[model samples]
Target: MKIYPFLKNLSLVYVLALVVSCVGDPIEQPIGKFESGVLIINEGSFGANDGDIHHYDPISGDLQPNVFESANARPFAGLIQQVRVVDGLAYIVANTGKVEIVQAADFRSVGAVNDSKLKIPRDLQVIGQKLFISDYGPYDENWNNTESFVAVVNGLQGGAVHKQIPVPSRPEGMALIGSELWAACASGSQLVVINPATEEVARTVEVSAGSPHFFVQFGANWYVYAMDAERVYFHRINHSAYSISETISIPLANAIYNGNFTMGTNGDVYIITTSGASARVAKVSIETGVVLDAEYFVGSNFYGLGFDSSSNTLYVGDHAGWQGNGQVWKVGPSGSLIDSFQAGRGPSGFLFR
Candidate 1:
């Protein structure tokens, strides 16, 4: 299929074809043409111009590295922070100052958005047809954060920001519960509730005196991870009144606050923490706010954790310093390694198709 690339001064004139190349390495289950696999996002060294994406097939044990450059003939400006794959498109957010949009099915460059409002974009969330980007706005001459806002952009229109909605400083992870959007401010110490209809701050939930960073929604309850305090703040929201019903705090042990986590099928949270040498994954219960498994899964350089509900398999991203390349492990619930494959540097995030 043909896809268009993002250009600054020119229109969408450059077209590229989407291609998939199989690796030479052989393994147990080879992925078919349309089979599901894993996509690993590598946050390359800052300013090193090495950020790239890797694709792995568990059945085939095939690993494809730097699929972005392979498909588009150009590299991402490095420092790739996160990638969100939704609506058949992959949105790659890099500290290099833009969101690169690509066709998810074939990894072809579709378009991009690098508006002035996107200075230091951190995270992204898609609600319906709109895309919300959390930006840590530029700093002043004194090295103080000027202001942080969420740039609202049209997912269908592309190439420009639709509007800038002011929020707390250093906005990070964002969650959408019904019509309300909750954004965590890493530097503001609160969770800012935004009413998308009005594009304004509805209210703020004081998570900590320090900062509330990442967030995940499980059923009717919302969990916000406060790294500065080593606590996970849970809240019950009142949608009608646009307020929080109740808030509970759950403290964690030996939390290093530098990894990614995901929710299991049974509503439990699997959080990863890297220690002096080894890494561990713990399961936190959503109902009781208790640690179900203090050491559910353990490894070295376990940078990312994800749960696949279809096969009940857990995929762990191991960036064990393999010369800028990484490894992905398919582990059982009991922490037993089932399979392992190669990937890119710092495999910090995953997307299963």
Candidate 2:
């Protein structure tokens, strides 16, 4: 008997689990119009064409899986990266090639952008009517930097890359502070600021030696998370000086990975980190720059973290390796487990709607 390519690297014990899931159809409910729920992005196994989005309704305790393909009557190709609900449409960035736009009311396909200029779209941020996306430009055939850029889309006139603003390599997370856009250089140790009006690189702010790959905005300041450095920086941008007025740093024990950090509704910052023994979510005070609680949510094999401000709920994604289906754990604001649902292969991040 020959092993398949996707499962060739699995251990003998885990191979049985993977075969059980692959052979039998996993239970999945048809997607529906969600009144209020968290939209979970599952980055299915690589090359399995299983990347999908699931809606978990807290009110009804229903898990609507594969909402994208079910509503569109077509499978979402490539890896489902990031998703943002703007206006009435949900912009789903499928990093394998394109960004899928769907109706927020009902997970239905509205439009898509897959221009040749998009090399590896990582993140998306909306400003007024424009959509700014960071593309981690891949190395060309010659194995050299291909010049990563931020592609601008006129959301008012359908999704299309009207212009591209060149930036540093491997741009990831992005946030809008007033009229300026702050983008993190994932492979570099700096944050690039761009003027949305001019669509030009205004300036770059140097940070600790690490990849600043994630961000969250609270009030007038911006919280930039340097994943490699395990530090979250509070940057107060001064318009008059065109520089950071004040920067406060919060140190952590473990390196932050994708979907590890999120902000709470009560103005608290929560981040998931591992301490060798177990994965833990830490709550940090925004005002004092201190860890209010070190082990807010603790579990083994935890991969992602998200907070729902409306109901004060905390959602965690646990991936027990690539052998079986992943899980989305629902916990209260106090870190009590409410419920858990079976999600796709890797339930990475959540878009609370």
Candidate 3:
């Protein structure tokens, strides 16, 4: 027989094509696409336990014990206070008056700044190529009579001190809103706007009791989130028109150490109240003081709050030491617990670029 080779092969090819179509999907659900973050908690070595820097995954909800641990990485043999992760470098603030740079990928010590260079650097704020470190100068062990310094350093220079610009008193938290460096004087309720070009204090935005912590600039407004002896104040942004027009309270007394908050794309504000007995993160419409939802971390240690606009994910770190292993949790748009991951000690605060 004249073997009908073409016809015999055609049937087999058609069957194979049908089998391929019945296979699984090519595009998998991006459940874990959201990048995880590191929590660098200063293990207070005094009477407090050594602070732990934890790594948390928003996808898996796992909290690793310690990411960066050691004496050199640990500035004072005390605690690792503040941290700024730029590119892949981790700039950690040591209460003993030094800032150490570690590999963000592995938390290995890359370099460090001495006391003479950085006098008790608190949280870090970056502008262009310069890093504006909140230098709350050291005094007696009782931590009295302190003045704030904004040490502008080269981002690439590991421990090199560029120039230390003096502010009013003990600047703890800082935010680079537009071109102005708003210094949050932790000891005093004052916001000094610094000019990065001249390193001069342009003006001061007066706050209530607590000083400004982490800030977010939204819609021609620089929200100066400050707190005093009793309450946390939200000073609306007015760059070209600088003033504290409207302010709001936390509904609870003393919202201190609340670094966990982020402004949503829709102009909504999300905040976590750790200082209060509530120990929860609440979402609210910034235009109104209405609470839409709140996430109560009753038993967990909570500290810093950050928002990622890309995936619309919210990150929170644990500051309490008793929690042992700290955490970095992922909150959904509705302020729901989506996922979590393991983290290092005290995962104080994190920045997502």
- Using lDDT as the measure, the top candidate is 2
- Candidate 3 stretches with Cα past 4 Å from truth are 1-49, 57-65, 69-78, 103-109, 140-142, 160-162, 208-210, 245-250, 258-260, 274-278, 293-297, 308-314, 319-323, 327-342, 351-353
Candidate 2 structure, TM-score to reference: 0.82
Which ranges in model 1 have alpha carbons more than 4 Å from their true place?
1-35, 140-144, 155-157, 208-210, 321-323
What TM-score does prediction 1 earn? 0.82
Put the candidates in TM-score order, highest first.
Answer: 2, 1, 3
Better model by TM-score, 1 or 3?
A: 1
lDDT of 3 by residue, 131-225 (tens): 77787776767767466678887755455777878776778777777778887775666777899888778988777545676566766666767
| TM-score for all models, in order of appearance | 0.82, 0.82, 0.71
Q: On lDDT, who's better, 1 or 2? A: 2
